[model samples]
Target: MDQDQTYEYRGYRLVAKPADNGARCWAWRDGVPVHKLIGCDVPDAIQRTRNAIDSDLGVAARDGDAGDAAYTRALEAVLPELSTGQLKMLQARYRAPDRIITATELAKAAGYSNYSGANLQYGNLGKAVHAHHPVDLPVRSNGTLVYTCALADSPDLEPSATEDDSHWRWRMLPSLAFALCALGLVAK
Candidate 1:
């Protein structure tokens, strides 16, 4: 098949031609063949090719290494069972480095009309973090939360003065008591 026979769509040149075994589609970017789509209809192949190109371009534009590092940290923080939306939220949070993110902001970015949906997603994220990490995250009255990267030093885990310190202390008391009991400093 002649390489000249190609179709351009969304900055990608697609060519459906004969391969050694069967017909396949080749997607080229900047005169370099980047992807091969096999065993799919022409439209499907074209869509897949466009998606691949878009994803590649997005990563390239966003500093792929930094995005990858943030994504990796997010993966470590969250549970294995995560939805794509939840994963995106976590990635955005991790990428921002010391920013306190709210469910409303995450929901807005995720294209949701209401914070309720985002709240549920954030709840899931919190559960995943608590289950996996040794530290408990501080939660605000408005349901906002903060997460610093694992590389951060001397993170302030203290509850706000306005917030009920008793609530926070109570939540951690069981664990603290257990440690004291283990050290024989306190009776069980």
Candidate 2:
């Protein structure tokens, strides 16, 4: 029952407290108790707490919370090369996550009156995606597609350091194509 004792587990501070049945381990984040593992001994409770923290962190990373900066940088690197219409469509698609973006919807967002204009804009966006992202993004028959901003699928697309600054260079060249392929850039 000593509240003073605490142990760090998976970047979380955990405290083991004695309960009537067994010991309960509580994990704290930013000094707030976030998780609790009851009906276990100190070691088991600690392990459970660690597992919970690891799972939470993994989910956060996958959900675009942990790697937001890297994702933003990757998108920003290709932003300049995109046209105004493509940029507008991309922004609209990104805003609607987990939802299918249709050509009509894209056209409306891009200030186009007809679906054909939106379809053309979508084609431009597809080319941009292929040139910059180089990822296999599926498009449905209705021109419906789900756009994810995270670079989780493209692990080989890493940010390389330069002599001047530690920024990711987005310049695509024929010479670097071989290297990029070797790094699984061309692989689906």
- For candidate 1, the clash count comes to 0
Q: Return the number of clashes found in candidate 2.
A: 0
Error of 2 at 54 (Å): 17
Per-residue alpha-carbon lDDT of candidate 2 for residues 1-188, written as tens digits (9 for 90 to 100): 44534798667899877565545788998989999985233433554566568788874221222222333444456656757776566555434332234555667778888657765655554454445445444465888553322221211245443332122222211112222223333321
Instruction: Record all residue pairs in model 2 with backbone atoms less than 3 Å apart, i.e. clashing.
Output: none
Tell me the lDDT of model 2 at 60: 28
Kindly list the per-residue Cα lDDT of model 1 for residues 23-102, writing each as its tens digit.
46788789898998642233333434554666777642111112223433444545457676765554443333232344
Q: How does model 2 score by TM-score?
A: 0.34
Clashing pairs in 1: none
Full-model lDDT for every candidate: 0.44, 0.48
Report how far off residue 43 is in candidate 1 (Å).
43
Model 2 lDDT, residue 56, Cα: 83
| Per-model TM-score versus the true fold | 0.32, 0.34
Clashes of each: 0, 0
